[model samples]
Target: MIDVGLLLTMIVAVGVPSLVARWWPLTTFGEPVGFLDVAIWPAMVGLGVGRLVAVALDGPSSLGSLSDLLIIRSGVEFWPGVAAAMLAAAWSAHRSGVASFDRLADLVPLALIGYAGYEATCLVRDGCYGPETSLGIRPPGTSTTMLPVGILAAIAVVVGAVVLHRQLGRRASWAVVMGGLTVVAGVRSLAAIWLPHIGDGLTRQHWSSIAVLLATVPALTAGVLGGHPATRERQLLDR
Candidate 1:
């Protein structure tokens, strides 16, 4: 079977910028970047980082031999890819003379939706799953199942993307949109605790989600206090 998770990531990696290039409102930063920088660069960097982190998580065994690093099949983790993409966007923006945060803000919508799409693949693959429940839906031939964690995550990301996309152009604000993204991470983490298949202790995803949530708290607070860009612009216009 085709690796649905990897397939979705590739789709999002390519599809988002293709759409942005044509219809996206031109931003001071994004306006300068060609599709290769925005889409291709991030995807390539993300894939490398995703593999690196997965190997790191594999402990001494993965680090024992250089050959272990070449096992690309085992390095297909999701959150690492997202982290790499974020960093890659910032680096690319810096190299291209665009504001890092501005470029990040522009990409947030697609990133969130991409994340959600990635989560949806769990439905088709034996990927990360939640704790088994009496109410859970099982795949064919399986006697046990868990809560639809992936489906829930997908819903959260899609909704968050829609909320942020409304602020495209001059109305975009990192505080508002990224705050929403952080909330999704925190929520998915909270939900994951009840999942039966997460194995023992806090997994990498849990730690990353918590880290993201903690990091985003200040931004969310500041955004709520300072108000969204749209509101500020409207206030200025009123004056």
Candidate 2:
């Protein structure tokens, strides 16, 4: 049987962005970005990529049938999903002939909120546990007391999103995209500290998170130091 609770949560997670993006008033290169493209395409594409990646990582034995692969209850790779979603968003913007960076800035918070909501569902589902820890509370039905990595990561992402929205949402800048992603990748890195390594003393998530942090931090710094060209242009146009 399908998990009704998780299914509903997923729907809400995706739905909120789709509804809100319709009226959020975002633009790229002085043109409005398509709401459905921003809010829906990335998420759907990401889910598919994440699911496939997870199954591949787990090996063919994990894939019982086409139906099994289709059902997300099995597992999904979080990092791959995020990367694919971002690519999908960029592609959507590109297809619409927009520069994408400014549009991405406005969309970042909504994406983070939706991501956090989806991760929150990890609390009730299997396959999201952290390494066995005697220090923290144990999830129900599990004998080993795990670190509750999923919920903690979800909380961290939500907090990051709120902070980003409050601090930078008023102005459209590349910082929103870079900063939001930095926070998320940092959270993933932290979570990886408690997760068991698949190989080489680091989980794939850890490597991915580190890579993102490295790429985004410098870009975020430069954007802040130089000021967003779009924001500056907007200021000049207003004057």
Candidate 3:
């Protein structure tokens, strides 16, 4: 039987971001860019690439058949998906004649909120259980009391989204993008420590997060030193 709940979850994962990105008033160099028009490209490409990456990481046994591979209700790796989506967004922005970095910065808030929405779905999904603890809720069909990490993560990211949104009113600079990403990566690294099955010491994700955190510093500096205007909207707003 088709898992309707999972299907809905997937829809929200893709739809919420796309809708937000679409309606989002993304401006670059004092001009409006129709990110709303190209939102679906990134969403679809990210989902496809993320699913493929997950299957590859899981090995051949997880592949099963071509039909099975097409089933995307489960088995997605987060970082890979995010990377693919970013690449897609960059390409889309370029094709639309908008500078990529500004658009990406504008996209950060939507990404955070979208992640929160995805995590909300995890509250009911079969997996994403956190480490067992007294301060946790036992998900359906599971005896162990697992932390409500999904909801907590959702709340956390929602807060982040609000902060970033307020920081960037109608336009975005590369500095904002790098800073937001750094914060988010750090948060993810910290949160992953409490995930079930995480072993002692730094894992690949931790290393990746650290690398991202470090890399952003120079990028942020460059962005700031370059004297890029945070918002370039003319005093007279577009009608």
Compared with the true structure, all predictions reach lDDT values of 0.68, 0.74, 0.71
In model 1, the Cα lDDT at residue 207 comes to: 78
Candidate 1 per-residue C-alpha lDDT over 49-95 given as tens digits, one digit per residue, 9 for 90 to 100:
77777877775567667787756666555577767877888887789
Candidate 2, 103-206: lDDT as tens digits: 57767867777777667776565545788777865766667877778788888987887776664534445677888889888888888787655566876667
Q: In terms of TM-score, how similar is model 1 to the real structure? A: 0.75
In candidate 1 the C-alpha lDDT for residue 126 amounts to 60
Please identify model 1 stretches exceeding 4 Å from their true place.
1-5, 12-37, 64-67, 70-81, 131-136, 169-172, 198-200, 229-239
TM-score for each of the candidates: 0.75, 0.73, 0.74
Clashes of each: 4, 0, 1
**Model 3, span 1-239: residue lDDT tens:** 87877877767765776666555555553565443345567877888888888788776676767876788865666667778888998887787688787778777877776777778897657655778888778877888988877778778877777766666743336677876776667667767777655567786666777777788778766755655243333423442
After the best TM-score superposition of candidate 2, give how far the Cα of residue 195 lies from its true spot, in angstroms.
4.1
Question: How big is the positional error of residue 238 in model 2, measured in Å on the Cα after superposition?
Answer: 16
Worst 10-residue lDDT window for candidate 1 reads: 28-37
